[model samples]
Target: MADIAVSTRGLVKIYSNTVKALDGVSINVNHGEIFAVLGPNGAGKTTLMRILTTQLRPTSGEAYVLGYNVVSDGDKVRRFIGYVPQEFSVWTDLSGYENLLIYAKIYGVPRHEINERINEVLRFMDLSDASKRLVRTYSGGMIRRLEIATALLIEPEILFLDEPTIGLDPAARKMVWDKLTALNKELGLTIFFNSHYMDEVEMYADRLVILNKGKVVVEGAADELKRSVGGEVVELTVDDMSKTVHRVNEMNSLGIRDVNIDNDRGIVRVIVDNAEEALPVIITTLRDAGVRIIKASISRPTLDDVFLKYVGGKISEEGRLQEVRTLRSVIKKG
Candidate 1:
């Protein structure tokens, strides 16, 4: 328990007696590790982050951050942790240096050490050259880094980031993650984040928990979760969907139990123990069955595949939009 950075027991959050925002959720995150809470839109990721950050209360159950109870010991918990919410929390009218300075003063950093801390955070966030520029003038990624730098001015033991890289371009997202990774490694700071980006979670999170409809559906290291869904995925683009489906059905005899056929795209995705060994045999079988293969590739199972297995769907942009519509409908009915 002492080594655990965060722990929750049967957590639940109900909104207006109609919606169960969190349903008996429980998880543990180890110290000095980057832990990710992942889920689709409206999956209570934000609710959980707010609860852990002492901004919201759970209807039932308990949450501890760095061994401090989030509810009863919120003040102590605040002292030990920093939080960056989904929205940009910065003074856009003020310079980056001024923003950090204000935060340092608010966090009660010693007057003598305020400038030193500001300079340190600016350098760490790679914003030293732009420290005197108004935050409004910064790029989206730079604004995010500035926000993070403000959070770090307090030198908290753990950091909580909610959708930290949500709307940035690929390059900007990578830059933000680079700083986070460095902070975790160099300072041994425990980082807990809520993210929908599977690739980012796969790359940075030491472990992750996937929540759906207010409950955890799966939790593990990225590789462990991927393996749980099965092994490598052998994808083939075939010219004849019917013949390919028939030949793939025969693959069941070869111990390949998980096979998916996308007739629309003429893609066959097969889950096997080893794709490298299975690909040749599969191609030969298809060829012998008079099936023409247009293209074939083998890839290890991805986090998106893991999500699809547990959530029963892809968490794409369209899925997020659907979630929003569904939530609105429920709220209207309530």
Candidate 2:
């Protein structure tokens, strides 16, 4: 536990005595790592961030950040962490320099060192040229970077970002991530963020936790999580849908246990230990059974597949809707 930057045990949060926002959630985030918290909307991702950031308290259980208890030592925790919420936290009317200056003073930076630190952060965020411009004139990505720059004024050891790139275009998102990466590498900052974007997590996160229904369904390095789902995925396109389904079911007898059929798309997804060996048998069986094989391909498991395997559903807008409905039903029954 000495190297752990954040830790929680039996964390639980309930609202209005009916809804359980966090249910026995527990996790460990190691020091100096980019750790990601991922879940569908309303999956307690933000709730966990709030608790750890000392903005909200859990109904029960304990949490610690940077060796300080979040609840009992909130002041100390605030000193060691910087938080960037999903929404912009900057003053639109203020120039970027003034914004940083205000936050630096609020953080109690030495008066003589205030301008020095502000200029350092502005250059670090690549906003030095635009620092004099009013934030209202900045682009979406520029605004995000300014927010991050403000958070850095205190030189926090651990930075918390909630959906940092939610609405930015691809280029803008990349720019934000690039600044984060630089901070992590150059300054040894620990980054803890919650993101709905799987690609970002896969690319930048050193480790991650997937929470569902207020519980940690899975936690590990992205590569390890993907491997846990099994090996390569074999997607088969067949002419006869029903026949293909029947043939795929027969594969169960051959110890191919994970097969999914999408009748609407005329495709069967098979999870196999070794695609090279399994592909031959699969094709032979389908052909012999008079099922026309139109195409077949093998691919490595993606983060989406890993999410589906554990979450038991696709990770999409519709999936979040379903989760909300399920939560409401449970609350009503309770």
Candidate 3:
């Protein structure tokens, strides 16, 4: 759809000391569609979000939300957009109704319609029953629902949620997800968000973009990308890799692309054109080699594989290395 709702061209942001947070990131989100940005911690997802919400200015390039420059017309942009940060923002010391009433006054809602609007939003958020209850008594999920309700007070054209379901239990996360889905489907609010949870994005987003170290690695629908693997992945664990490797080499006649060794685990990963058809030959070869098989599994490509495919051989390997170094130090100290 040519209805471009959010557009950024060469968007770059550097810190006060010139540490680049966003590096020439450009993306377009269509109107009335759900778009998700996926990344690990410190991958610049929050930084990009802050720039869009007008909390931080970009160091270079331009960003537009609802056809207005984020820097020049920030007030106008804020009027049409609602942002829910990762942290809990609602005043915990006040009652549900009290917070909304105060926000109504701050936003300058019409004096006569304030009551009607407040009541309508409270009911929609399922907080009408707890309207008078102090926020300290509300559950985490309820508070998040109330936060979303407040964001909707201005009838925003777009909603940006950053890790919206973080810190909630599984059931609470699902409830938040269901409510978000309802808003997107019934009201057609253009939802934009970032989350580390893959399953959540798979469920709620119509489209997704994965970012690694400040750049989009891939962008597309969940199902399409999951099913796009050109070959099957077979993971085999063996007691004697040397024997297994020799036998697996015989299957090269079966149209195999590559056979990789997992020396640490005494396993092998075989990638073939048609995994199902080659299974009999593969099994026959392994049995003939007198190798003991520990475990074997076949799987279609997943979002994890997609991430590794585009990102590189070692996706998020930096964190793993850090953990290894930390563990080594702990062991040495002990």
TM-score of each: 0.88, 0.89, 0.84
Q: Pick the candidate with the highest lDDT.
A: 1
Per-residue C-alpha lDDT of model 1 across residues 22-84, encoded as one tens digit per residue: 999999999999999998888889999999999989999999998999999999999988889
Global lDDT of model 1: 0.88
User: Model 3 TM-score?
Assistant: 0.84
Which portions of model 2 show Cα errors greater than 4 Å? 237-246, 252-257, 261-267, 290-295, 314-334
Q: Let me know the TM-score candidate 1 reaches against the reference structure.
A: 0.88
Better of 1 and 3 by TM-score: 1
Clashing pairs in 2: none
lDDT of 3 by residue, 3-61 (tens): 98899998888765335567788898999999999877766799899999999999999
Model 2 clashes, total count: 0
Cα lDDT tens digits, model 2, 1-334, are: 3699999999999876666789999999998899999887888899999999999989999999988999999999999899999987999999999999999988999999999999999999999999999999999999999999989988899999999999999999999999999899988899999987899999999999998878899999999998887888888988876777677777764546477664445677787778877898889999889888889998778787688778755444465677577678877877
Q: Rank the candidates by TM-score, best first.
A: 2, 1, 3
